[model samples]
Target: MTKEANAAYDSSWTFIFAWLLLGISLLISGVRDLYDPAASAWTTWLGFISSAVFLLMAVNGMRLRRRRRESAEPAGAAS
Candidate 1:
């Protein structure tokens, strides 16, 4: 791949990684808050849901990107 294409690929993965990290952090925080007596029930559930959304986004992004790359590859070379 050309340098530009390689860079873009790396950047896309980086973005996905960032989202994954964000989701993990949110999930951890939500779990932690779940055990805290002072934590609000609504906010904890919100954080949990938000984390699920971010994680889903990251996974979907990775799947879509991989599909695109595979489709762009030559049929024989795809092996």
Candidate 2:
């Protein structure tokens, strides 16, 4: 592949993999949380934090993919 295309290809996969791994981590954390005897408030707070973390990663991955796609497009192409 051309260098530009290859760069975008690599970038998209990298972000995707990162986000996916983050998701898996959260899943694992959720399971652990289930077994923990922490106070309800603490568990709720932890869950909120995990959701926020996932949201951040997911947003970043989507943005990276969008940016790479835009960059890959030809300048004069039709909308």
Specify the highest-TM-score model's number. Answer: 1
Model 2 has how many clashing residue pairs? 0
Clashes per candidate, residues 3 or more apart or on different chains: 0, 0
Estimate the TM-score for candidate 2: 0.51
- Considering only N, C-alpha and C atoms within 3 Å, which residue pairs clash in candidate 1? none
Q: Any idea what lDDT model 2 has?
A: 0.63
Writing each residue's lDDT as its tens digit, candidate 2 over 1-79 gives: 9755665566566556656655665666667667774534454565556656655665676677678778878989737
Provide TM-scores for the models. Answer: 0.54, 0.51
TM-score of 1: 0.54
List pairs with backbone clashes in candidate 2.
none
Q: Model 2: residues >4 Å from true position, as ranges?
A: 1-38
Clashes of 1: 0
Local distance difference test, per candidate? Answer: 0.65, 0.63
